[model samples]
Target: MRHARNNELTDRRSAASDAKAALLTAYRAAKTAAEPSRSARQAERISLVEAREARRAERERLKHEEQTRIVTLAAQKQAAIEAAEGAEIEARNSAENARISRVVEDEAARKAERDRRYAARKSRQA
Candidate 1:
């Protein structure tokens, strides 16, 4: 009877140890199963952050390009206006020079004609 009772005690202890091992195994499996999902979530978060940063950088680059374009256009417009003004001034100067040249030519022609008539009259008188 004592031998049987000792066997029963040993059996209970063996069963308890088996239950503890099974619980530990289940805990490890649960943690292992959750690890992949945790890692995936972390990777997803990193990707999202990277994508957002990329978009921001692209926007900034575009904005900078736009500003540069605007400035370049403004400079070009200013240069064009200055060129137009210079051309106008040159045209006015050319017209003034032409008028002066015509006046000088007319005065010289009148003087030549008067001198020719006087020379002819002097010859006729002699």
Candidate 2:
């Protein structure tokens, strides 16, 4: 019985050592095989990140351009409005000047008529 128990213990130790050696060999193979896959995945992720950043930058540029276009349009509209308002003011001033000239001419005609009537009446009395 003692010899049999010693044999069983030896078998267990040998099996455990063999298992350890097989696990080490498999780990070495997996380590060598995994490098290319890991590098490829990392490179792919970096490229995707770069593409997204470029797209974001392009979108920002387009947005800025749109804003600039809108501002330019607004400025043009403002200039047109100012020009139209200035023309309207000039027209009103010209109409008022014409009306004042007509009023002055009418007053002169009335004064001349009154002087002529006075001179004729004085001559008749003499």
Model 1: per-residue Cα lDDT over 1-126, one tens digit each: 999999999999999999999999999999899999989999999999999999999999999999999999999999999999999999999999999999999999999999999999999999
Clashes of 1: 0
lDDT of 1: 0.98
Strongest candidate by lDDT: 1
Model 2 over residues 55-74: C-alpha lDDT tens digits? 99999999999999999999
Estimated TM-score per prediction? 0.58, 0.67
Which candidate should be chosen as best, given TM-score against the real structure?
A: 2
Clashes of 2: 0
